[model samples]
Target: MSWAIIQQSLPMFGKGFELTLWLSFVGIIGSIVVGLICSLVQYFRVPVFRQIASVYVEISRNTPLLIQLFFLYYAFPVLGIKFGAQLCGIIGLIFLGGSYMAEGFTGGFNGVSKSQVESGKAIGLSRWQLARYVVFPQGFSLSVPAMAANVIFLIKETSIFTVIAIPELTNTALDLIGMYYRSNEYLFVLVIAYAIILVPLSIILTLLEKRVRYGTFGN
Candidate 1:
């Protein structure tokens, strides 16, 4: 591990880090939105949408993110649908992450007490009102730990974006190693770079989980 090589490579890694952060941020938000909608559809057992959401969750969760990215970046263009590398990476992350998030959220939604749901209905609360006043709050609280895990998972998944030519952390490290043949130095930095982003994120998520747990259960 040459310190000089590590130091020299910081600028390239910085750019890659920024791109990775951007991709992860966008992917996380998009996945959460998609997941919430799907979970709600499933939870409410919406006629056609419930089946669609179920099939979508199965397909997205079963498929690999790399394959998704390949289809978006390579195969789509053959049919006149075109997406840039970055866009493909973002879409791939959202496509993959959304399924997992949906499952997590569904589990949370299902954990809501049946009696409480009945009570809400007994009070003449409509489906939307029950969802807003009774279900979503408790469900979201129950799902926080799982959601945090998914966020970290999605962030780590950004490493594979390199295959789609996204200039993210892993790509920058690989490029430097190819040019300088300093695999140890570059790889060391790559690991550290990821740690820099994920470690604090994990800690923060842990704290958030504890807070939510305390707030929800009074424990």
Candidate 2:
């Protein structure tokens, strides 16, 4: 907490926090795309794909992320795929986050009453039409809050990337500690730095949850 240490760590923490923000943003987008696709497969019960998505979600959720990162970084190279630590870290985190998001969306799909879907079918709508025009839009509201929470969780989870030398916030804080041997001072800034990025996301997600509910149920 010394003034000198605070001044010294600012640049390092800022740079690292920037990288963490960018990494989380990119990973969350990738996870959302993957999650939605997988959810669709599960919804329609596509041939063999439901099985595949199930396996993926179960395995990803069951395994620790650190292990996934190691597999991506160490095992993939053995299979002739070259990747930097940052790339590998992103891939692992996306795979992990996508599974959780898919589960959340599946819950959303369930939240839409079967009667709504039946009504869509009664209107001469095909399954695809019902899903696109009716079901997905309505059902997705049921899970948007969970989905947003998952995204926020992904932001905090980026702390693990420090283990991979990803130059994220935690990594830079540790580096500062190493350089100045002021672990206490650097750690405090690290906590605040992450909070600065994440606290607003939490607030946004809460507001979004209310909005989704209002749109789906209130109106």
Candidate 3:
């Protein structure tokens, strides 16, 4: 409602948005890598690694990002394992997002037809070769929708970074509200900032999903 307040807050919000983008980008990438590793471990039923991956997924998925962030930012320092707030934020996002991504990827792997796997075996494809050539491609394609959802989820989860005093968008908004007492204006700006990033991102992911679904991405 107060354009002046909103205008004055733009620089702060811009900086916060920049940090949010960085955190989200790093988190998404890390989560994808972690998820891929875990899912592959499970898919292959690796000896000890499969059990470890399953336990890790269960723990990560069961816990809240806030709790994980607190442990990383607050609890770990008590044990002499300290990380900066930004690092903690990134780790928290990856920790939580990775589990969801693993599940998504596992689902994608499951969606791979059994006959196709058999066919790959019949062709004398090694396990690794089959995974690289047949399984990974189809699984990733099947995973597009879930991956998009998880990316969006991780981006939104960055809001929780405020608890760790990360200068992300939500923190910026809270600071503005505390300083000016214009909760509505700051909240509106916060919403708009997220919309600016997420709206286009959502549209792009949707388009990518459609392309993957019908445009021969995995084939």
Candidate 4:
């Protein structure tokens, strides 16, 4: 195996990695928000939103992330929709992550006690206060484990962005492979790159789960 040389095209890789991280961060945030909105709508049994959320969750969750990426990348153009590659990646990640996040939120919403919900109402909490102080806190806390898991899942899923040409971490590695003409070395770099990302993410989430497990959020 040829020895690995650090490609001086470092800025390119940096840009790609930054794009990956930013998109993942934005996607996670967006999906969580979408999930919260959907979960709340369904929890209240809102007539229209609930039906929409139900069908959306089922469809998005049922589809593979890669196929969804392709749908946005390839299929959307057939309908006269034009999205940038980055935008397509972001949207794909959002929908994919939203499905998992919504399921997590739904589980949390279901697990929350009705009495607690009523107790909030008994205190004369307004709709905003009820959701902000009462429902969201408990529901989110109860879902912390799920949230952590979702974070990890979505991070890994970001690799799919390469399929849509988002130039993420994997793309950088492939770039190095062709440029360096050292397949094994670049493969090692690929493993190292992902390992660097995955190890830290796992450790962080595990610690988060520990903190949440011992904390009193369930009432």
User: Which segments of candidate 2 are over 4 A away from where they belong?
Assistant: none
User: Candidate 3 local accuracy as lDDT?
Assistant: 0.94
| Structural similarity to truth (TM-score) of each candidate | 0.96, 0.95, 0.96, 0.86
Instruction: Put down candidate 3 lDDT per residue, 53-98, tens digits, no spaces.
Output: 9999999999899999999998999999999999999999999989
Q: Count the backbone clashes (under 3 Å) in each candidate.
A: 0, 0, 0, 0
lDDT of 1: 0.93
lDDT of 4 by residue, 9-110 (tens): 456657766777788899999999998888888877899889999999999999999999899989999999989998998898899888789999888766
Model 4 regions more than 4 Å off:
1-4, 7-11, 114-134
Q: How would you order the candidates by lDDT, starting with the best?
A: 3, 1, 2, 4
RMSD per model, one decimal? 1.2, 1.3, 1.3, 2.6
9 in model 4: Cα distance from truth in Å? 6.1
**Candidate 3 Cα errors over 4 Å, as ranges:** 217-219
User: lDDT of candidate 2?
Assistant: 0.88
Worst 10 residues of 3 by lDDT: 210-219
After TM-score superposition, the amount by which residue 194's alpha carbon in candidate 2 deviates from its true location, in angstroms, is 0.9
**Model 2 per-residue lDDT at 139:** 75
